[model samples]
Target: MKPIKNVCVVGLGTLGTQIAIQAAAYGYNVDAYDPKPDAFATMQTKVKAAMQMTRKGPTFPMALWDAHAAKVRLHSSLAAALLTADLVVEVVPEDVESKRKVFAELDRLAPIDALLATNSSSIPISRIESVTTRPEKCLNIHFYQPAVGMNMADIMGGSKTSPETLQAARVFVRSLGCVPLMVQKETLGFCFNSIWRAVKRQSLYMWDGGFVDFRDIDRAWMTFTGMTYGPFFLMDLVGLDIIYAIENIYFESSQDPRDAPPASLKQKIARGELGVKAGIGFYKYPDPECTREGFLLGA
Candidate 1:
């Protein structure tokens, strides 16, 4: 098996920075690329905020994040980023067309032998691999925010993804001190994310239908799960804009009206209430209601 030494992450948005930092912390040469000039800096702030909110997610000290992060070389162009990459993780917008464009660029620029993967939360790699020449080398290697201590990766192979490519990705994920949750077959929102998606969907429906206040739902979740946050809180961390987009993908796929994301959720996005990144969403950030005393105790 060819060991992966260099990791390149495309689109340093919500998940990219954490992924990059984790790879670098584990001794991999990491590079990141994002079209937005200030994307990396913005992501850094979000990560720091996440690190503060989390205790068990981050594997290293907050002080060490900068050192590990500094190890990543940021590039202005995709070609430069993929030049030395052995594995490329694409974290672009979760739309199929948007992903197609990125995979095409990645296929054209990345070294022929390098493996290409997408960190898309819901869409599977099968919808993307056709855009690349090396379909066998393409797979879905999804990650949650590892920088905050969720150190598991969802690993799934596309229709044509080779056994070798899938095996190599498993090795790479393990090297980062992560549990690689293998998907035996193609599935949207693979593994834990699929479970998370179900929670998000039901939560949004209830809120939109006026069945219950979002906070009450969150309180119940935290109360039962013993987690620091609930479904709505986690969605904010994922970004409301991203949540809306992923929901749309589900609606478009199933053509089920019931599967549609709530209209109010779209309004929130339209108003720029894009969760933690925007400082507001289901709750205000850095000091959301979920964190207040007596929130879970129903005060």
Candidate 2:
């Protein structure tokens, strides 16, 4: 509430690292933490890359670098990170049980008034809130991948999330140069994932029915909608395993058949064909050439 001088990012994965770097760039003293010590090095590398990227833009603010180096600190211990945190954002993997464990620990370790937020893509804020004693301060601050590039964010409130807490989160997110849309009620997939699942269902149906190949599907969206990447490409960028996990959670939470990830995806996941990160998915990416394999069906 007091302008969030010091913040803690609880998980230093891809999303968490981006969020922490962005916050630091905004002049907030940041304490970044992960259970793994190797994560510290990974996060630092990411921050350096992000800083270089920002420097290339004409509109980039130079003040961010000075504040970032002076204000941000990385830690491997949860206690060390949460000790002086005024706001704590949890970006752990999208497992409800895992989130519950993190939230329980945060509630115990962080200050009582610290604004606790989750960056979950699909998991409900209500479920996360249930694990914490101070549910009134628990909320969701969903940021898209590459948080520095994406300006849109969602501020989702659980049943127990207080108005004051929501307002604080909105202000904080805005300070990071992001647009925050407040979701009045908490839902299983929130806004983005729900809409994404619907789109994915249709795409998977086409793929499974042999109606279209991956290239055609991607081209259709890019050509017509003017999107930077098509569904398949975006899925690959997001990591096939992560996409599968979200769909599985959506199916479990809503019991909706449409939310179920198709057999093709399950089979690929089972075979360890996890997309760009894993070097294979809808399309193959050879090491030297990076050539695409699938052809456009209707082109």
Name the regions of candidate 2 deviating beyond 4 angstroms: 43-71, 285-299
Q: Residue 139, candidate 1: how far off, in angstroms?
A: 0.4
- How far is 274's C-alpha from truth in model 2 (Å)? 2.0
Per-model CA lDDT versus the true structure = 0.88, 0.75
On residues 186-251, what C-alpha lDDT tens digit does candidate 1 reach at each position?
Answer: 877888888888999999999999999999999899889888888898888889999998988888
- Against the true structure, candidate 1 has what lDDT? 0.88
Clashing pairs in 2: none
Clashing pairs in model 1, backbone N/Cα/C closer than 3 A = 57-148, 57-149, 58-149
